[model samples]
Every structure is written in structure tokens, then in C-alpha cells.
Target chain A: MNILTINGISKNFGSIAALKNVSFFVPEGSVYGILGPNGSGKTTLLGIVTDVLRASSGAYKFYDGSKPVNEIRKDMGVLLETPNFYPYLSARQNLNIVAKIKGCDAAEITKALKKVNLIERQHSSFKTYSLGMKQRLAIASTLLGDPKIVILDEPTNGLDPEGISEIRQLIKLLAKEGKTIILASHLLDEVEKVCTHVAILKKGELLVSGDIDGTLSKKHGSTGENLTEQKEKTMMEVVSDDLEKLAGVLKTLNGILDINESEGVITVSCHTDELTAQQVNKHCFDNGIILSRLTVKNKNLESKFLELTK
Target chain B: MLHLLNIEFLKLQRNRSFLILIILFIVSVFGANYIVYEVSTNTGHIVHETSNKSFRLFEFPEVWQFVSFISSFLLIIPCFTVIMHTCSEYTYRTHRQNIIDGLSREQYITAKILYVVSLALFATILTVACAFFIGMLGNDPISFRDFRCVFYFFIQALTYIGLSFLLALLIKKAVLTIGIFFIYSFLIENILEKNLNRLNTGIENIGHFLPLSSSDHLLMFDILKTAMRLANIESYAPENAYLTASVIYIVLIGYACYYLYKKRDL
Candidate 1:
């Protein structure tokens, strides 16, 4: 089931169009990632759907599409841009305010604090928290009221490596509990690791959106195959002592679909299932061309993102 | 509305600045009233006399007027409080957080309006308490009729605090909003009223309806004039007219706040 349906959403800040008729749907129980570079309207799109921003022209509906945005928001947990809470208030007090606003029980505050592992330090004021703790507390806030849908914009924005991994694990755990998570991130590696579905946005416009593996595979010119099957088409870089002879032999090979040389390295694009890296080396050796290096490159989101975005 | 108000109160209860401001208001009101009581009952001083009757500042019937007039000056405390509370939401970006947490725009405005009303009501109750304290301390017998100024003082506080809320909504910055608020109340309105009064009585009559001065006119406490005449003169505008104007200002300012809140992007 589709949890959110955004239709023709557009937002303009005076003259600059932040989001231009952008539209997408978040499916139930999927960790949907909104991938975009800086100034790509990722935050703007999240703001519009969460009603923090007024769209210049557009409409969006949550849940069954029968409730008002505010009413539906009661079931959604959102953290946009930064962790916004009263600096003077402690984390527990801040989350208590959130729980009160959502009409949730006070016990939920305790549970959320525990979930973020801040139960011991919950009484410390928000300003006293370090950046990692602040981000963790923000993630914990989304757990209050046990919301069915969570919208997080750059949840791991300024965290250390350990903190980033912890947030990524938390997101996966939330998704495991059957919550629909919409994560907006500019980090390709984070999305690739955590998201079940992905939407790539550029300059406020959606380039493509679908299942993460499917989108990556399609962008790689796969014939509607699963990611594992798409992996059959791998490119290997081979540099031989005798480059001219190695290139001539590679071109004659059946599995070698395309061969090109730059400077001294010969890159051979071939079907991995038909021709393995060892076979490429064996073939070059049989031709009396000694090889210096041979490395296989499997296509990943990083490469696909750069290819499509570029 | 009550739920929103409850959340607002909870937030305020935890705010140190708000608690400090309320304590200051209480202390200032009582301390000022005590000083007035001391000066009025002193037998040695004879500032004014009417038919050989020395002026009694804290005497009942007039004490209510005196208390209300003196306390009204401290309306700035509540006004500043309202400004700080409303503008903190923007400064902290908690206003956006509140909406994202499930409050509709109208509910947010309603919560703020409720807050302003509560502060006004609090100020009114404090004034009444101070008046009763002074009346009991004085030798003059107290009458319920002496407490009519309490209602005017309530409306007056509402007008001032409501005006503050409107300014905060438009300005969004605490310091700038409070600056504009002080300037308008202290200087701009006075200048305009002075210039208009000089133009002609007709223009000055219209000037009495200006938001701040209109409420100030509600509780007219010219202590010297009242002492010389030995009678409680009514307000410049009829009591009902002043009350009506105050109610109108509150409603208009509130509606304007709601309109702006609904239209602006958080």
C-alpha cells in the first residue's frame, strides 16, 4: 500500500523555485531514501509533505487519503533539517512536550529516551548535549507515540563514523518493526546501505525513483533482471606487459564485449558469467602476454548515482 | 483549545525566564501598592485638601482606582512576557516543530491566544488582590462598588498583551518586536495623540480610540483632579464604550494574528 501520495507539489521562495511539480509515493514498510545533492530541494520536499512549508501549488495526502494533514501528522514522526527543541529544556522535558502535543502518554517519553540510550542523561539540558547525542535524541523523538510513518531529513547529517553507523542501524531496526521510513540524504553510501527503496532528485526535480536495486540495475542497462543477475555484466581492468598483444587477444575473445585502453591500462568490459578474471589472465598468458594487474569492478549505487546525476 | 493551552502552560512552567518574570510582576505590584498605602495614611503630609478634607490616597472607593492606575504601568511586564513567549517559538523554531508534532495552524494560534488571555486574566486577578489588600489596610470601609476598576484593568491588560502578541506574530524576532512595542506604546502613540489634540478637539476625540490610549483612557486616574473635585470622575469614553473598544481591539488583533499565522510559512 502507498503510505504517502504527493501530487504535483511545487514550492517557490519568492522567485526561486525550490520544488517544481515534484511527485512521489512512499510504499508501506519500505525504507524510502530521498537522494539528492545540496540545494536539490530534498529538505524542501520533506517540509512540504510535513506541512512545515506551504507549497506554491500542489497537494499531498497521507494514510487513507481521508484525513486532514494535521490529523494524519499525528501518526507521523518528522525530523526536518535540524534537531529543534528548547535549548533550556532537558531532553526528557523536550520529549514530554512532544508527547503532550501528540497526546501520548508520559511513559512514552521514558521509552523514547531509553531507545536512544539517553535515559541516564535525559535530565541534561539540550544545549549541554554533544552533536552525536543531539542527533540520537532527535531520532528518539521520532519514536514517541510509536508513529507508523517516520520522515527524517538528513538524520545522520553531522555524526562521527560510529554515530552514523548507529543511526543507520537504528533506521534498519525501525524498518524491521514494519514502520515506513522516509529518509532524505545526500550521502549515497548511507542510502545504499540502509534504504529498501530510493528516489533520486536533482535541482528540485525527481530523476528516477523505485526499488533501490531495480533502479540501479535499470540505470546500468540491465534487462529487467535482479541485481545479482545484473552483476553478470562486470568490467575488469587488465594491464599486460605487452599491451598491444593483450588488447588484440581481448578483442578476439567471445565474452569480452568492449575493450579500451587509456595510457597503459586496458579496460575490458565482459560478461562475468562467461569470462572470469582468472580466465582473462589465463587467456593473456596463453597469448604469451604477461599481465601486471587485473581487477574486477562491480557496479554499485555510487557509480550509478554519479553516472545518472552527471 | 484546552489541550493546546495545557501544553503551553506546561512549557511555560518549565521556562525559568517566564517564572522569573511572573515573580517580578508579583513583587513589583505588591511593593508599589505598599508604598502608596504608606504615603496615603501618613498624618503629617497634607498635599491637597477639599473643603478642609485632606486627600486620602488609599481610602476605599478611590483606592480601587488608585491601585488600578498604578498597576497598569506594570502592564509592560506582562506585555514583555507575551512577546518573549511568542517570539521564542520562532527563535527556537519550535513553532515549526509544534506543527510537525500534530498541531494545526489554527490550534497553534489558539494556544497563543489562550496564553495571552491567561496572562491578562492573571494580571487582572493580581490587581484585584492588591486592591483588596490595600482596602483592608486602610481605615475606610470597603464597598463592592469600589472594585469596578478591576474589570477595566483586566480589559486594559488584555489590550496591551494582545497588542504584544500581534506585534510578535508580525515581527517574529524578540528584540525587534519588543523594541517596536516599547517605541509605539511609549513614544509613537503619545506623539500622535499630542499632535492630534493640538489640531482640534474633533481630531483628538478620534485619537482617544487609538489602541493603547483607548485602554489607558478606560481607567482615568488623575489623582490631583479626583482629590480636588472630591469625586470619582468617570472615564473619558463612557465605560461601556471603552469596554466595547477594548473588546474590539482584542478580537481584531487576535484575528489578525490568526490570519498571519495561517498564511505564513513556518
Candidate 2:
């Protein structure tokens, strides 16, 4: 069953179009990821879906049959932007408030806290909560009443690596329970790891979307029948402090996918089958330049997002 | 609606400001009544001694009037208190959470109205209890006749609180709305009345219709006289005109509050 169907939804603020005729379907029990750049209408799209902001045109249908939007919202859960709770209220009290609105028993509050692993600190005021805990509480609130569709925007944002791993595990567990998840995030690797299906958006337009493997393979220029003909190439992602100098040095090398600089991070994608990380580091040291970060991994979501967004 | 009302009361109970305002009003009510009792006693004794007659000055309508008069001054706290409570939902962004947590716009609005009404009733009960206690302190304690008059005055106090909350919803902020409510309800009405009286063409014709004026006059049991003074015609006294005007003001303002709250984003 289709959990959510957004049809030709467009939102504009003054002259700047936040979402331009965006359309997508969230199938039941899939971890769907929405990938976009910083100002690419990710938050706006989530806001409209969560009913916090109205769309300028178009309509969306959720899985509550033909009920009104307000009633349909009971089966849907959304966490938008930053976590917002009553700062003076304890985490338990905040969840109790959510329970009251959802018309569920307070038992669900405890259940939600347990789901987020915040039951130990449920008595702590939201003001005392770290950013990770606040986000966890937000996720807890969304899980209350056993909502069918969980929409999270930037779910693991502002978390340390450990917190990120914890949240990613939680999201995986929730999806395993058959809850449809729609994740909107700018962090490409996080989405790539967690989401089953992926959508790429740029400049308020849908660039592409499909199953993650299919979409990533298509971006890397793979045809459906050409799987056996694909060559095995080892990929390495290099992050350097001095992007211009590093790009100049990388330009003189072979076996480089491409060197791209965005904002400040310069990524040198080299085919590791011919030259390894040690070779790149040695060449950088010989050229009197320092390499800030170097790692070897497959060409993943970040590369795909950068390719589409750029 | 009952569930929403229950949630609203829970919020009101938890709010520090709401508790503080109620406590302050409770203290102010008894404190003001003590002053009224002391002054009335002194005046009654002087009248009895000078005239060589027992002056039941604190009996019947006089005690009711004295208590109600003192109460008018203290009613501002509850008015502003409820206003702040209503506007807090908007200014503090609690309204957004309220919506996110399964409250429809209508339910959200209903919760606020229920909260405002609850506060108004609470204020009215406190005012009445203070009046009853002040009556006990009088030289001639209030009879049932005086108690009935105080009951009417309590209704007027409840209306005043409701009107204040309605004004708050219309303005959607505590500071500016409550400031304007106080200035216009207390000072502007008086200044307008005095200006109208100076005109000599008609006396304060429109001042009584100003939100709190009719209720104030009705609570003091000068409804007919005040209406006559407002209309400025010599013998045309609209009987119970204060009742008519007060009812109309409450309904119209209540409707306006509902309308604006429904359309407002927050």
C-alpha cells in the first residue's frame, strides 16, 4: 500500500520557489531518504508534509482512507527542523502532553521513552538535555501512540559519532517493525546507510529517485543488462585542507576519478586499484603539502549528491 | 472538548505564573476588603453618633456596593493574568506543539476559551468569598438581602474577567493588550465620560458601552441611573439597559475572539 502520495505539490514564498511541483510516493514499510543541499527545500517539504506549513498548491494523501487531514494526522508522526519542547517540562511530562493530544494512555509515554532509550533520564527537564537527548525525546514523541508513518528531518543531526550510531540503530529497528520512514537529510552518508529508497532534489526540483542500489548504480552510469561487464575499480575519497594546491597536485596524477571542491572540503577520488592512499600521501608530502583527511571507500551517496547538486 | 478542557486545566495548574496570579489575587481580595471594612466602620460610627440614630451603613446595598467597589480595583490582576495565559500559547510557541500533538485548530481554540472561562470563574469565586468575609467584619453584618446583591456583583466580576480574556485573544499579546485594556477600561472611559458631560449636549452617551463600564455600573446597582446619565435624555430611563448592554458586549466580544482565533496562524 502507498503510505503517502504527494501530487504536484508546490510551495512558494514570495518569488522564491521553495518546492516546485514536487511529487513522490512513500511505499509501505520502506526507509525512504530525501537528499538535497542546504537550501534545496528539504525542510520546507517536511514542514508541509507535517502540516506545519501549507502548500501553495496541490494535495497529499496519507493512508487514513478518506478521513479529514486532522484525523489522518493521528496515524502520522513528524519531526521537523530542530527539536522543540517545553524547556521547563520534564521529558516525561513532554511525552505526557503528546499522549494527551494523541488521546492515548500515559503508558505510551513510557513506551516512547524506552524506544528512544531515554527512560533513565525521563525526569530531566528538557532544558538540561543535550542536543542528542533532545532529538531523542523528539523521536520518542513521534513514536507515541504507535504511529504508522514516521517522518524525520535530519534525524541524526548535531550528534557525535556514538549518538549517530545509536540513532541509526534506532531508526533501523523502527523500520524493521514495518513502520514506513521518510527521512529528509543533507548528510548523504547517513541517508545512504539507513534508507532503502532514495530521492535526490536540487533547486526545488526532483533530480531522480529509485531504490538506493539502482539509483546509485545509474548515477555511476550502469545499464540494467550490463552488470557482468562492470569493471572492479577501488575508490578512495581524500579530504585535503588546501583544496587548490591539492587539486593541482592531483591533476598531475593518473587513476583519479575527479577532484571536486565545494565550500572548503576538497575530495580527490582516486582509483585505488592503480595507486593507494600511501602513494597519495607520499606524493602530497613530496610536493610540500599536508593531507588533512584521507580514506578509501566506494563512491557513495555524498558523491552522488554532489554530482546531482553541482 | 472535555478532554481538551482537562488538559488545559492541567497546564493552568502547572503554570507558575497562573498560580502566582491566583495567589496574589486571593491576597489582594482579602486585603482590600479589610480596608473597606475599616473605612465603612469608621464612617458608620460617626454617622450614628452625630445623628443619635443607629446607622446600618454596612447593611444591604451599602455593604455590597463597598465590597464591589474595592473589588473593581483588584480585578485587574486576574484580568491580566488570564490574558497572559491566553497569549502565552502564541508567544511561547506552545501553540505549535499543541497542533503537532494532535490538536486540531478548533480543539486548540476551544482549549483556550475553556482556560479563560475557568480563570474568570475562579476570580469571581475569590471576589465573592472576600465579600462574604468583609460582610462578617461589618458593625451590622450583611443580611440575606446583602448576600443576594453580592451574588449579582460576582456575576459582574466574572464578566469582567471574560472580557479581559477576549480582549487578549483579539490582540494576541499580553503586554500591549493588557496595557490597552487597562487604560481604555479604567482611564479612557472616565475621561470620555467627563468630556461628554462637559459638552452639555448629552451626558456620556457612548462611554457606558465601553467594555467594562456597563458591567461596573450594573455591579454597583446604579444600572438605571447610569444608563440614564449615559443616554443624556431627561426622563427616558431604559430599564435594565446595563444588563442589555453587558450581554451584548460579552456575546460580541466572545464571537470576535472565536473568529480571530480560528483565522490566526498561531
CAPRI verdict (incorrect, acceptable, medium, high) for model 2: acceptable
Off by over 4 Å in 2: A12-17, A199-235, A238-300, A307-310, B47-58, B61-66, B137-177, B187-204, B223-239
Model 1: residues >4 Å from true position, as ranges?
A217-300, B43-45, B48-51, B54-56, B200-204, B222-235
Single out the weakest 10-residue window by summed lDDT for candidate 1 chain B. B226-235
Per-residue error at B70 for model 2, in Å? 2.9
lDDT score, residue B245, model 2? 76
Pairs clashing in candidate 2?
Answer: none
Candidate 2 residue A295 C-alpha distance from true site, Å: 4.3
Docking class of 1: medium
Question: First chain TM-score in every candidate?
Answer: 0.79, 0.77
lDDT of 1 by residue, B97-156 (tens): 999999999998999999999999999899888988888877778877657788889889
Per-residue lDDT over B1-266 for candidate 2, one digit per residue giving the tens place of the 0 to 100 score: 78888878766656778788888888888887787567757896897799887554345545665566667678788887778877776665667667766677778777877766666677667766776666666556456664544555555666677778777777888899888888887788889865664565664445554567667766653443455658965232242676677778777766777777665434
User: What's the TM for model 2?
Assistant: 0.79
